[model samples]
Target chain A: MRSYKDIHNILLDRIKGGEWEPGALVPSEADLAREFGCTRVTVNRAMQALADSGLIERRRKAGTRVVQRMTRNAVFEIQLVRHEIEQRGGTYKYLLISRSEEKPPQKVRAEMGLSGDNALLHVISLHFADGAPYQLEDRWISLDTVTQARREPFDAISPNEWLLREIPYTNAEHVFRASRAEPMDAEFLNLGEGEPVFVIERTTWLSDAAVTHVRLVHPADSFRLVTRDQHGTAL
Target chain B: MRSYKDIHNILLDRIKGGEWEPGALVPSEADLAREFGCTRVTVNRAMQALADSGLIERRRKAGTRVVQRMTRNAVFEIQLVRHEIEQRGGTYKYLLISRSEEKPPQKVRAEMGLSGDNALLHVISLHFADGAPYQLEDRWISLDTVTQARREPFDAISPNEWLLREIPYTNAEHVFRASRAEPMDAEFLNLGEGEPVFVIERTTWLSDAAVTHVRLVHPADSFRLVTRDQHGTAL
Candidate 1:
């Protein structure tokens, strides 16, 4: 006999296949049980799981309905720069501007939950797509966690790409905001000072251990971060 | 008899409880089955579910381990303005600046996938948080979907809130970007022109019926949209 998981998959396929249009009422548990030759309890389990995933809506009077594909919230992938550029059929390039061992700035220290006098790897790099500046990355790495990162030549590979291969992180935090381009950012990203820019700040951790903190800036009109559904609809 | 889902929940509790830290290898399926008093197949099913959710990484020779929490993507809620302000312990105020029926601009019409000559209800409103301008809202409502909206007084309730209560929309598309504050937006948001602004554009639909399109703009320093995991970590 097929389990509830199987039933769940079947129903999910139906939804993904557009078998039931959004907002259309689906069969009740009893009806579904009869159709699948299963107990109502099994059908209920399947339906409940669907509801939890926001694929369906159930009410006492309304029964079950395929949820109108609402503007969905999607977890977007933190894509790799090389992959993003390559996917767009552009030549990808990386430039390591500077690398130094220095005390982290106050804000970086606060975000990493570090106190005074802690040394960190401060690195700045530029990523290009089709020979045009794509993003400017400013990063700080925890020297305590990945000690070997201090010696690796970052000119060959971006710090982010290198860290991913060397250390494994278990948690990450990301912040998205808008900012006017500073003079330094303007020089790197080739945008005018004070132009609107999309800023992404990320902190990764290995359990409770802070691994790295990075800030990426992209020119507003040139780049956009998108989240979407399986049907390619913006979510 | 307990189902695989019960085993799944038990394992999930262990992960949440920090019994196995991120990047720690989990016990094999056979061992898990022995501990839980279940078949290995049941344990496998539970493990598979966890892997699907990005909680665990499974490899052929290396075995399963807690996934390094990479930069996570999250779905952001298109929250109500009143709820947001009230939650933040501020007074919520709304002002209807203008209301008219007119043909949408080319860009707006293109986004809604509408052709020429269709009249939409255009509305401009400001949301205030504690007597300060919180956001500027420019909206276009499709007259075909909600005919009664033409006569409803918007002075009392914002169009977004009203749509949520009255209409049964199933889908929405959202675009988040950064833009320079235009002259009108600078005046409305109490910011200097050319300052950065976070902009969110959303299009809501009832199945195939386009319902509304709205653009919300907030001053860069005053507002930010955040996405996070349940643990309050940014995702």
Candidate 2:
């Protein structure tokens, strides 16, 4: 018997192959079931998978249609520094330049939604790929959320990898932009002052409580963010 | 009566609420069905939705578990330039700087996988938001894929919006990076030479044929890409 997964693949092929075409309302589940010589449940399962993948639009009353103006989504699973480097066949190294419990700056506080008298565990580190500077990391962990981080030895483990193992977060926001390398960034990344740098600011939350804020900087020529959709090939 | 969506919400709350916690194996579908007074199919539907949303991971033998290292995804609906500006309360304007049918540069040909003797429709345009230069777009459309574009009037409509309406593509790749504005870019964007510029290179494909390649450059301080997860508040 043809499984629902087979039907799902067939439907995806039709969408990508332009056989069904965009903005075309798909036949009802019952019709699909009859065509495939399967039950309505099997066809529904395939349709649901397509809908979840953002390939089709489904309505309770209006039925399902291929998205008119296809909005492609690039989904990326944020990975660890070590894993990211190792996956590219480069040896990974970590260096902790500074660690202290101090009051965050106004920008950090604003991003984390912290008010007066709030202090965070601020840590600055450098990550290396194949003995070259890869990323400059400036991170702040909420003392209220990860209390154990106060005494944690960051030299042995980067705060990012440590927190991933210790605390679980439910929400996050990522902002991507380009910036000129400041003096401090130039020194750390071994780049000239005013060189272009790719920047990413991530704020993670544990439900309603803000957990950590991190700023990662990379040499413009060295790093880029790529996202790929599963329905098609990525180049 | 409670539906699969109800079960999905309840399970998500438990995961995000820390009741189940990360890396914790969830109850089997049979158990969940019994508790919800429903069939295994209903519980399966809820579980499938959770897995699709990256809230949970499933394995045949190990069963389902709250993801240990939470990786979030940001989905963006690529919209028209006019809509993007109008939605932000800015008047949209378009200027076609240049349009010609010519041999594409080597880099573009390489990116598009085009061979010798093949020419493309090359277009350069500026998108303005509220009388300010918002984005500088350099685009190339494969004549083989979009033969109708040769005679199109780009002065009235932007090529990006035009292609989206004319041709439906199946695959795309987006590369986001930072660079210093060159002299030409500085003049076009009204920015100081060597200032940081946010660059996005997008290549779209239809089935196995490459359709278009575009590079969009924006002032770093003026634009940023924001991605948010569906389950949480957008910050």
Candidate 3:
């Protein structure tokens, strides 16, 4: 109860005081509980909360240790389309192909937390890096979440920009997976059948309510994903 | 300098000791340098490294503050096929469809960091979940890296299994994207040519060099990538 909150504050105070530096091992659950004069579960809850905040790394046998800063967040920040284009030495361009209304599928309905068989504003477009095919984006928008979307013409603007302008979002869920090239996908993406393609699907939300679900696909032969890693030693 | 190593150790020590709690601002470069009795570059290196490790958040104007672990490295240990299947509430099954050596493509050769044009042991296979098309995997192995391949009927065994047994890997990089289904990709995945699919590509390394690359594509509507957030965060 209040003791746990006090424990949390004490723990935060110690960390802020630089007593437990990054990559340093803290006391075990038992040790923490005994020192704080509280049950182990309370200590466990505090430590778990700290770990969830990205302050420490937990290992089964090695116990928990603070993480080094070098191992932090995806270095590039979610692969901004602009940086990706510049890296290829190409000027990035975007075009909104079309926008239409349709009922969302079961998954989108559930993911977006839509109650009824609600209709969504679907936007399709192409992204080009140096005047070449970069990504084919097909997105479904929940009009209930963002009413402004119903009036926007996605053609003159990219769906990304359009969404960012018209909607204020709280969180986003992302999923990346691979799949084979479909004929329509191939025609839009300029690939042959049986060809491999890279796909990234992202869903943005406002609290527990989902907002937009977008699928961005790239021809496998045309894209590369890069990230820097610390040479093992991250807890 | 020997102090540089001690610097990382010390910084980590303070954080774990609770002196640098989550969201607490850190000392400036000049101040840290003065404290460590090292060059500003050394402190910069240390703090930069700390920031990189995700122990602290830094912005031009916001200064540096202890970061909470929002992401917490959802370290998905994508298991071997057997493990993936076993976890899926189904009987695990694997089949090796084809194998051969081919002159690796220019891009693939580059990915493998191979010199000039080289032949690669191409392994193709399919795994089943309850006798349904679970996954269609296409993999390319560096012949020069692993010698155990020149012989064996992989029909009963899987390349994923063989790789784990015969090859020792030190690192792996994964990417996911979405694409339209092609005829072959559609047929194998049991989807229409225009259907969307999820694709994941993984490159495995033995030490610093790549040993193999694999591409996995799944029917989009069939499944969703599942993960729980460590933060009370959505997305």
What is the DockQ for all candidates, taken in turn? 0.31, 0.50, 0.09
True-structure lDDT of candidate 2: 0.85
Sort the candidates on DockQ, descending order. 2, 1, 3
Show pairs that collide, candidate 2: none
Could you tell me every candidate's TM-score relative to the true structure? 0.78, 0.90, 0.54
lDDT of 3 at A74: 27
Whole-model lDDT, model 1:
0.80
For model 1, residues A27-113, the per-residue Cα lDDT tens digits are 889998988899998898788777756778899977999876433455566667877888889999999999999998899988887
What is the Cα-based TM-score of model 1?
0.78
- Model 2 per-residue lDDT at B188: 92
Q: Pick the candidate with the highest DockQ.
A: 2
| lDDT, candidate 2, B1-235, per-residue tens | 6699899989988976679988899999999999999999899988887886677899987899988754566665567778888988999999999999889889999988877758798899999999999899999999898889988979989998888877877677788899889887898999999899999999988877889999999988888887765553211
Evaluating just chain A, the predictions reach TM-scores of 0.76, 0.92, 0.66
lDDT per residue for candidate 3 within A55-166, as digits (tens), equals 5678876888865542222221344565568766889888878789998788877776678888899998998988878899889988887778888887777877666544
